[model samples]
Target: MKHPVTPDGRYFVVRGRLWRMSNPKLDETQRSKLTNRLMSARRAVRAAKTANDQSAEAAAHRAVDDAKRVLGERGPVWWNDGSPDLNRHLAKNTPYAEWYGQIGRSRPGGT
Candidate 1:
C-alpha cells in the first residue's frame, strides 16, 4: 500500500492535503535545543513589544523562523524530491483534487 507520509516522516497526507510534521530524525538533544531557541525567541518577541525594541523584535523573529525552518515547519522542504510542496493546500483545490474526494471517504476527520 502507498504510504501517506514521505520516507523521511517530514510530511504526511490527509485527504490529499500535505501537512508538514517535524522531522522525526531529530535527536532528543537537538530537538530540546531547538525548542529552547524557539521559546526564547517567542519570549523575546513579547519583551521587545513591551520595550518597543524594533530591532530586537526583528532579530527574535528571524531566530524563531530559523528554529522553525530547522524543525521542518517552514522554509524549504526537507525532501530533496522535485515535487512541489502542497502545504496549506486543500485536496479539492490541488492536482490531487480529482481523487481527493474519493479518499475523503476513508479520511480520519472525514471533512
Candidate 2:
C-alpha cells in the first residue's frame, strides 16, 4: 500500500508492493468487508491525488468530492497494524459488526 508523504511537497510514495491478505479472527464476512473498504480507500486516495494534480482547480475539486463521496463512512474505520477494530462505529450507536455483519465465514457455495 502507498503512503502519503510530505517530505517537502505533498506526495505519496508508491511502495509498489502488495501484501498477503489474511486474518484468523476475521471470518470470511469480516475479511470481505475490510477488503472492500481497503480497496475503496485506495481508489479514493488515488482519485483525490489525481484530481489534485491532473485536473483544473474546479474539476479537481469535483474529483476529490466524488472520491470522498465514494469513501462514504468508511474513512475513520481503518485496517491498522494487521487488524481491524470491528467495534469502530461511523455513528454513536453503530458498530462495524452491526453494519457489515460477522467476519471469517466462507463465501456461499463452498464445498
Candidate 3:
C-alpha cells in the first residue's frame, strides 16, 4: 500500500520503495485516521518487543488488532493472512522481502 512520508514528499511503500500510486489523494479525516492506526501498530510492536514469554503473542495480536481498528476492515484483512499462527521459523527461514513476496503470491493484489 502507498503511505505518505511527510508533508512534502509523496507516498511510498512500507519497505521504502517508491509507490506506483504517486500523488494519491486522501482526505484529512482519512489521513488522521490512518495516522492514528499507524501509531497503534507501532505501540503493538513495542508491547510485543517488551513481552518476555508466550504472552507476547497477546501483545502481537493487540498490535494487529489496533492496526485493524485504525485501518478498519482493510487493515484487519491485511493482517489476517496467517491467522493465529506465530511461527518463529517464518522469521528465521526468510528475509522480510522474501516473506512479503511469498505472501503476495499467496494473496494476489493484497486481497
Q: What is the TM-score of each candidate against the true structure?
A: 0.62, 0.30, 0.34
Residues 1-111 of candidate 3 have per-residue lDDT tens digits of: 343232223222343242222223556788576667667766766766677544765766676665544443233222324543222223223333454455445553541
Candidate 3 segments exceeding 4 Å error: 1-23, 53-111
The TM-score between candidate 1 and the true structure equals 0.62
- Per-candidate Cα lDDT values, in order, are 0.74, 0.37, 0.44
Tens-digit lDDT string for candidate 1 (10-40): 5556645767766667898998899899899
Poorly placed runs, candidate 2 (over 4 Å): 1-21, 53-111
Highest TM-score scorer: 1
Candidate 2, residues 11-111: lDDT per residue as tens digits? Answer: 22222211222333457776666557666656665776776754444454554444433333233333345544322222213222222222212323211
RMSD of 3: 11.9
Alpha carbon deviation, residue 26, candidate 3 (Å): 2.2
TM-score of 2: 0.30
Off by over 4 Å in 1: 1-19, 90-92, 95-111
Among all candidates shown, the one with the greatest lDDT: 1
Error of 2 at 31 (Å): 0.5
